[model samples]
Target: MDCIANLASEKAVVIFSKSLCCMSHAITRLFQEQGVSPMVHELDQHPRGKEIEMALKRLGCTPAVPAVFIGGKFLGTANSVMTAHINGSLNKMLKDAGALWL
Candidate 1:
């Protein structure tokens, strides 16, 4: 949990994911389409994958993978991610995170 928090603070955007998850791919593509380079941490590949997933769960992220962080803040689940984009607030969030230079 502390590691994830540190990562969130270090990167403009980070997606905690599992390699085979479609939602993780969707989350990655969403940020790419918006022109933001998001750092992806594939938990399944990490040594502490299960631990990370549990930590994320405690953080209120469901289904684990694709948990997003922007500007050191949790951005909720994949649906919230899509919703933010649809609402046009995602761009602003990215901008505020310094992930979007445009």
Candidate 2:
């Protein structure tokens, strides 16, 4: 639990995703397009799934695949991420996360 928190805390941006999800893929591509190398953790492959379980519990959310975090703060679902992009907030969020220069 502590280790997972530490890892999450260390990264400016972290995206927990399932490889099969289209929304997840889209977000990944968007980040790539912007040249942001977000720390990605695939929940399906996570050895410490319990740690992620606990983190999601802390956020009052059921462990749904593709949880995104910016500067260690939960930013909700992929649709929310896309909405952020559509609304022009995603770029600012990425910049704040140090994932982009502009």
Candidate 3:
């Protein structure tokens, strides 16, 4: 849990992801398209990946991968991100987190 927290706080926007997950890819692309350079941690390639995944599971991430954090706060899974985007709050969050200047 401490590891997860530390990693999440390392940047304005952090995405805990698996390199090949399509959802993770899409979410990353979305942020990039918006000109937000999020810090992406590929869990499958991390040494303590499983431990982090379990921690994310405890935090209620159903699929574990693609867990997101903004401004050191947990923002949840792919659905949550997509919903925030659809509701027009995603850009606000990005700006607030300093991941977007526009």
TM-score of every prediction relative to native: 0.95, 0.79, 0.97
- Predicted candidate 2 versus true structure: per-residue lDDT over 1-102, tens digit per residue: 465567667677777776776766777777778788888877667887666756766765444656677777777767777788899998898788787886
Identify the runs in model 1 with alpha carbons over 4 angstroms from their true place. none
Give the clash count for each candidate.
Answer: 0, 0, 0
Candidate 2 wrongly placed segments (more than 4 Å): 1-4, 50-54, 57-63
The alpha-carbon lDDT assigned to residue 48 of candidate 1 equals 80
The lDDT-based order of candidates, best leading, equals 3, 1, 2
List RMSD in Å for every model shown: 0.9, 2.3, 0.6
lDDT for position 84 in model 1: 95
Which candidate ranks first by lDDT, i.e. highest?
3
The TM-score of predicted model 3 comes to 0.97
Across 1-102, the per-residue lDDT of candidate 1 in tens digits comes to 898798668789999999999999989998988888898889999898888899999998878878999999999889989999999999899999899988
- By TM-score rank, best first, the candidates go 3, 1, 2
Worst ten in a row by lDDT for model 2: 56-65
Alpha-carbon error at 43 in model 1, in Å? 0.2
Candidate 3 — which residues are off by over 4 angstroms? none
Candidates 1 and 2, the one with greater TM-score: 1
Candidate 3 per-residue lDDT, tens place, 33-55, comes to 98888999999999999999999
